[model samples]
Structures are given as structure tokens and as C-alpha cells.
Target: MNLVLGIDGGGTSCRAALATLAGDIIGRGKSGPANIMTDLTGARHNIVEAARLAFVDAGKDSTMISATDAVLGLAGTNVGGYRQQLEAVLPFRRSLVESDAVIALNGALGERDGAIAIIGTGSIFMSRKGAAMQTIGGWGFMLGDLGGGARIGRDLLQEVLVAHDDIRPGSELTHAVMAHFGGDPREIVKFAAASKPADFGNFAPLVFDFAARGDSVGSRVIARAVGDVEEALDALKLEPDQILCLLGGLAALIAPQLSHRYRMMLRPPLQDALGGAVSMAARLFGAPKGGADG
Candidate 1:
């Protein structure tokens, strides 16, 4: 089939891009979650399903996937044994599995020596300097992910709780949070009891929006989150001229608020994770002739 496939599989969904060996993306499709740690079999199924759909989108039969070389960037692939397990089951001529973060870095930096901060429901920072690579703070939301959307949302809920108990003064933001729960502190309590990282992350945008409007509570929450981001970047010790790409859902909100130092280093991503997966695939296996990508 003289084609390649790029797959981006996360807890929420799996996205597949079908391209020629020459690097022109011809089709793309998405399917259900493909989190290997939690559900390896399901992840494999979804991955193949996404690939099949991509082929369909490109006006080819699903069977063409058997001849396609692919690179998949998937959540939980970094955990021991899971990546190999999924790799063995995928329906492709040659397939490589990499941590989701890797493809995102490639997508953002495009072989540049720099760093990336993915601030979504959770956050992680990564850097690549030639063959040397470093990672910081992708430890999930319970104890880590301090600078992520989930953490900011959790902080907001805590502020609401403290204000409700008279332990802290309430502000417009906190009061608004309380009002969200029908002005009942116990409702906040009930919601928090069952909330997941993304459940809390839902409130992250509100915090940043309030901060933009000069609300004290929102501003403080955002400031702390910004501090966490800066702390991670400081750990990387990036060079002055090296670019830093901010990605994920909260990136837009956090970009303007970064310190002058990082602001100077910031640049937009060169491509998205799917594009990166395709790029990696092209590099690992020779692309077809007549491609002008170079």
C-alpha cells in the first residue's frame, strides 16, 4: 500500500492519520479510548478500529492496513510491558509504540532542542537535547500534576470549602463556585467525593477567566499554577535560544501569564501529535520517492 499511519491514542480517544510514505496526510479518523494500562485489549481494538477508519476515509479497504507501517503515540505505553503488548497485537506490517509525550514533543519541536509543557487535565514537561531526554511532573493528579488544569480546579474547590467554613475569606470567584453548587457547601462536598481529574479540570478555565478579570482568588490560583510551571521549566535549565512549546487544553490560558524568561523562549508547536507520529514513522522507515517534504 506504500503508506504509513500515525496514531494518537489517549484515555479519551484514539486518532489515526493515514499518509503516503511521502508525508502527505490523506485521511484521518478517531475512535474510542485506547488507554493500555487500564484496558489493554480495548486499547488494541480501538487502535485498529481507528486505523481501519482512516483507511476508509482515504477511500481504501481496511485490509490495506496489513501492509502499512505505523507509529502510535499512546497513553500508558510508557508503563512497563504494556507498550510491547499492544504493539504485538496491532494489525500493521511494522508498528512502533512510543509514549504519548514523545510524539507530542516531536510534533511541537520538530527535532529542535527544546522543551514542551502539556497543561491539560494533567500536566507534564519534557525536553530533548540531541539524544539526551528528560521528563518532569507527569505523575497524575492525586499528588503530582501541580501545574495542570486538574490541580487548579482542585485548588478552587478547596478555596470554596475553606471559605464556607469561615477558615478563609470568600471572594467573587469562591462565591461563584459555591453558587455553582446551589450555594450549598455540602453540594461541593458531595461533588468532590466522586470527582475525577477531568471533573475538577472542568473548572480550570473559570479560574483563569476570573484571573484575567482581576478577581483576587482566581488570580492567586493562576499565580500558583504558573509557579508550578515555572518550577518545572527551571528544572529543565533550557538554553536561552531554545524554544519552548506550550500544548494541551490550558496552554492558551497559561501562555500569557508565564514569566518574562519563559515568555521569551515560547514558540507555537510545529505540528500536533498525529503529525508527529507520521513524522516519526517517516524517519524510522524510508518515505517513498517524489516527496518534497525535505
Candidate 2:
């Protein structure tokens, strides 16, 4: 019973699916944060926990995880040597780690030639034209991740600080944002010094909320973010009629705001990242197996 494992590990949580070479799902499981770049040891623990839980869900011995081959599409894999590092410590018989964006694109477009913009807590854009794949961004919140929740939330904090200093005009959005930080710019400064991307990302919804109410600053922020998204799409060189998917937490919120050109190309994803991992596992590693127990 040779079965492949698919794991989608992200900053928030990780999901695992055990399936056959033919793409029949056997069992699935989930666990907490698996962002290897931020917490390698914790990610390792959660990755294995999720895999173990998948085996449990399948009513199989969790120890059999060591016998399984796996494909893990994970957040933070694009940074440094974390992919190889995480792979080295994984409990699988064999494992391949890829950036989270890869699985998202594959899941959305299946085998078709298309593109995806993953705009969640972080941002990354990718396109596949046959075998050639092009990716931009996904550098994480510090260096890049423009148009993502972290970026949006961080910008809101900045707007608050500047407005407090009288350097910029304050709007309802900024005023509300300041209260989110105890109404003290000093508290925002303190929080920023020790905050993770998720901490800032928690405020992203507020930006969209205010923007919807015609808050000037919120509108400006979202407009800038949309521009970044369009810029990335333009760089992908996707022609008209090519499928374009906007995935992740912000996808629905950002969709209608995109220019008509991009809006016309949008389509819903066919499956989630875990599904993509299993599909990729079959293509990358299970082709010869042609056989799976479940």
C-alpha cells in the first residue's frame, strides 16, 4: 500500500492529506503554524503532528508516516535554505518542499496554463505557461510581500503614527486604527518593535472595512495595494483569456477592486493547496507507482 502524502503548511496552520496515486483521498488532518522561516523547530513539530494526525484519520499506525513519501508546499520555503533545512528534518521516507505559492497555482489552475496571485498574510504572484513558471514576490513581510495583509496592516499603523504627528491627514480609518493600539502612537511603536507579521495582519480587515465606508486614507491604501497587484500581473505577461486566480484570505476582498482588465480574467480555484500537493505528488513521484493502497 504505497500512498503519497500532501501537506500544505502555512503561517497560520498546516493541513495534511493522504491519498492514492490516482488522487483518491484517504484521510486528512490539520495542526498549528508551520512557517519554517519564523519557527523551524515548531514547524517541524507541527508538520509531523499533522502527518501523524492524517495517518490516524486513516485508521493506520501513525508511525507509518516514516514509510510515506510526501510533498509539502509551505510558507517561508522561499527564504534562504529553509526548504532543504526543513526537508532534512522531516519524518517522511522522502519529501519535497516548495513555496506555498506553487501549490496554490497548481490547485487553482490544475494542469492548465494560467496564473495566480496569492494575497493572504503575505503576497506572491506566479504563472505557468506549459513547463515554464514565473514567480514574483513572496519575500515575506520584512523585505516584500507588497499588497498583503501584513503590508496593509503595517501601512495602517504608519498612517496612524503620521496622522498623530500631524504629518498626514487623519481619517476615520486612522482614528480607529489608533484606538486599536490603545490610542497611543507610542504603543504602536512599542508593538511594532516586537510584532510578527500576523500581529500586523490582524488589522488588515480594518483597512478594507474602512475603505468600503469611503474613508479617504483607507481608499488610498487599498488603491495603492491594487496597483501593486496589477503591476505584478502585468509583469507575468499573461495575455487576454488566460486564466487568473486570486487566492488566499484577501482574494475575495480584492477581486472586485481590480481593474476591469484583471477582473475580466478572474476565476475561482478548483481546489485548495492540499489538493495541489497530492496532485503534484502523483506527477512528481507516484507516476511509476500506478498503485496505491487506498
Candidate 3:
């Protein structure tokens, strides 16, 4: 029987699903981070590990990996060179590499034309109309991803520093952050110097939690992040009736914070990035004759 694999790799984790070419999923697996740009070797390892586990769960031979077609929607693929490098290393009969935002758009909108804002450790806004697709942000944490969890956590740390130096009024949120570092400013500096986006993103939920409880610093930080997200959405030039889906870990928390006008356009996704990858793979590689649906 013909099989296909769908992968959704992000900064936080990598997920894989084994399915028949007809679109029925047979098994699923998950592994650690797989952001190619940040950690190529690790991403490659995790991708293969996830695929191998999926095959095992499906009760198929591990060697069948070479016979399966795959579609991967991953973070950091938008940057130059990373996709090519990953494609060269991937073991599959056929494969497609796409930006995480593209898969999210596909999953959220299906056959309809619409927009999506993905906010997790990173953020990207995408819109599609027929064959044309446009994107904003998602330049990675350092260069962009302004409304992402990583950025929000980074800003929280900055606020902690400011409060330490008496530049800003300290709040319960800042106090909790300082406590996390043992109340030592130098420790925060040390952490920041060595930390990756995911490390910073670990603090994102705390920021949202504090914001929800009316902490001034947390409210200010989230407000800024929400503003940036709205600005990116505005740049999409969406139609009045076009639906917008908010996707990823931070989506639910950020949804209520968006302006009422934009909130009205928001809708839940029909599927997720992994499902979108499976759908794409099914389109690219048809099911074998007489093969079961899954």
C-alpha cells in the first residue's frame, strides 16, 4: 500500500502523521524542536526520529521511509538556504518543503481564500487568493516576529531589568520574573546571552497570566504585541467578508486582546498545519490502486 507522511516542525516541537494517500491518518508521532535555521543537525535528527516512530506506530517496516512521500511545513524554511539544506538531507521518495504559515493558511481556510495569523514562539500573517499568497513578519525572533511569544518574553525580561534599575515601576509580574532569576540581575544577563527563542518563549504564558490579572507591565507589553499583530493584518488588505483564523499556542490568549473590529473577523481553524501537510501530500501523490483509505 502507498503511504505518505505529514510533518509540522516548529521551534517548540516536531509532529508527524503517517497516512494513506487517500487522506486517512494511520499513526502519529512527536519529537523535540525542529527549527532548521536554529539547529540544523538537531532538526534533521528529530525529523527522522519522528518519522521512524510514526512508521513503528503504523506497524510498518522502518525501511518504508524511502518509499513514502512527505510534505513538511516548518518554521525557519522561509529563510534562504535552510530549506535547500533540509531538502538535501531528508530521506523520502518525494517531498515538499513549505513555510509553517503556508500550511496554517491551507489548514485554516481549506479550499476557500482567507487569511491566518500564527502566533506561537514565532508569528506570521498570511493571506491567499487563488494562486497568489502574501505574507508579513515571521523574519525570526531577532529580526521580526514582533507579536510572537518569544518577543513578548524578551520584552518581559527587559521590563524586569528596567524595574530593577528604578527606571520603571515594578509590578507583581516583574517581581515574579526577578524571583525566577534568584533576584540577581547578572543571572538574567547570563540567561539572555545564551538563550534561544524557545527559552524566552517559556515566559510567555506568565506574561499573559499577569496581564489577565491586571498587572500594569504585563498589560502594556501585551497591548504592544497585539498592536503589532493588528498592523500586520491590516497590511494584508483583506476583503470585508474574508475570514481570519488565529492559529498556534498563543492564539487563544491573544484573540480577546485584538481590537473588536478585527475580532469580528476571527474564526477557529478547520484543521491544523499537520493536517494541511497531509492534504497537500495527498494532492501531490495519489493513492495506489486498491489501497485502503488509510
Candidate 4:
């Protein structure tokens, strides 16, 4: 039997699933962060680890990895050179690499034309109209990803610093952040100098939690993030009936904060990125030439 492998590699974790050519899932596995741009070595290791674990869970020999066709939906695949480097090292007979946003859109909408906004440790907006596709944002943490968890957490830290300097009134949220850093501004500075986006993203849930509790600074931070998300959605120019799925770890937390107009357009995803990878793999390798699978 020909086996297919599907991978969803993100800033925070990597997931792998093993399935038959017929699309019945046999097993799934998970591993640590696999963002190619941020940590290439770690990404490579985790991808292999997740795949191996999936095979193990499926009662297959690890050596079968080289015979499996793989489809990877990964963050940073759109960045220069990273895809090529990662592809060169992937342990599969054949592989396809696509942006995480692409898989999110595919899984959310299936064969239908629609849009998806993925907001996690990073953010991106993707839409498909007939045969045409468009993407916005997802330029990584430094340049874009405005409404993402990392950006929200970064903004929270900045607010905390301002509050510490008496430029803004301190609140429970700011005090908690300060306490997390041992109430030493110098420690926060040192951490920021060495931290990655995932590190900053670790604080994102706190922002949402505090916002839900009516903390002033936390509410402001969430509102600003929502505005950025809305700006990206507006730029997509979606049709009135196009289904919009908010995806990623922060999707549920952020959805309620969006404007009423956007909320009205929102719909739940049909599947997830890993499932889309599997569907792509089947399309690429499971059927005969000239068939609908491709």
C-alpha cells in the first residue's frame, strides 16, 4: 500500500499524519516548534521526529519514510531560500511545500472559494476566487504579522514599560507582566534582546484573559490588534457571501473581539492545516493522470 504523509509545521509546533492513498487517516504525531525562518535546525529535527512518530503510531517501520509522499504546510516556506533548503533535507520520495496560509485556506474552504485569516504566533490572510488566489501580510515578526500573538504580546510588554515609567497608568495586567519579569525593567530588556517571537507569544493568552476581565491596557492592546486584523481583511476585498474562517491558536480568542460586520461573515473551519496537507498529497500522487485528484 502507498502511504501518504501530511505535515503542518508552525512557529510553535509540528504535526504529522499518516494516511492511505484513499484518505483514511491511520495515525498522527506531534513535536516541537518547526518555523524554518526562526530555527532551521530545530525545524528539520522536529519535522523528522514528527514523521517518524507518525509511522511508529501507525505500526509501520521508520524506514518507510523514504517511500512516502509528503505535503508540508509550513510557516516561512514563502520566505527566500528556506523552502529550497528545507526541501533538500526532507526525507521523502517526493514532497510539496506550501505556505501555512495556503493549507489553512484549503482546509477551511475545501473546493469552495473563500478566505481565511490565520492569527497565531504569526498572522496571514489568504483568499481564493475561482482559480485565482491572493495573500496578505505574513511577512514574519519584524516586518508584519501585526495582529498575531507575538505582536500582541510585544505590545503588552511595551505598555508595561510605559506604565513603569509613569507615562501610563499601571493596571493588574501590567503589574502581572512586571512581576513575571521579576519587577526589574533591566531583566525585561535583556530578555527582549534575546527572545524569539514564540517567546513573546507566550504572553498572548494573558492579554486576552485580562481584556476579558476589563483591564484597561489589555483592552486597548486587543482593540489595536483587532484593528490591524480588520485592515488586512478589508484589503482582501472579499465578496459578501464569501465565507471567512478565522484560524490558528488565537482564532477563538480574537474572533469575539472583531467588529460586528466581520463577525457576521465568520464561519468555522471544516478541517485544519494537517488535513489540507493530506488532501494535497492525495491530489498530487493518489490518482491517475488527467483525473480530478490533481
Which candidate should be chosen as best, given lDDT against the real structure? 1
Q: Candidate 1 — which pairs collide? A: none
lDDT of 2 by residue, 187-207 (tens): 899999999998889888889
Clashing pairs in 3: none
Q: For candidate 2, which ten residues in a row score worst on lDDT?
A: 285-294
Candidate 3 lDDT, tens digit per residue, 1-294? 488898999877999999987778898989999989989999989988899999999888979898888889998786799999999888887778888878778778887888999899889899999989999988889989989999999999999999999998989999999998999999999999999998899999999999999999999999999999999999999887889999978999999998887889988888888998887777667644432222
Superposed model 3: Cα runs more than 4 Å off: 11-13, 31-33, 38-42, 179-183, 287-294
Model 3 weakest lDDT span, ten residues long:
285-294
| Candidate 2 regions with alpha-carbon error over 4 angstroms | 38-41, 181-183, 289-294
Candidate 1 Cα deviation (angstroms), residue 205: 0.9
Select the stronger candidate by TM-score from 2 and 3: 2
Q: How displaced is residue 266 in candidate 2, in Å?
A: 0.7
**TM-score of candidate 2 relative to the true fold:** 0.90
lDDT of 3 at 262: 83
Q: On lDDT, who's better, 1 or 2?
A: 1
C-alpha RMSD of each candidate structure in angstroms: 3.0, 2.9, 3.7, 2.9
lDDT tens readout by residue for model 4, 1-294 = 488888999877999999888767798989999999988889989998999999999999989999888889998787799998898888887878888878778878887888999998989999899989999998878889999999998899999999999998989999999998899998888988999998899999999999999999999999999999999999999877889999988999999988888888899888888998887777677766622321
TM-score of each: 0.94, 0.90, 0.86, 0.86
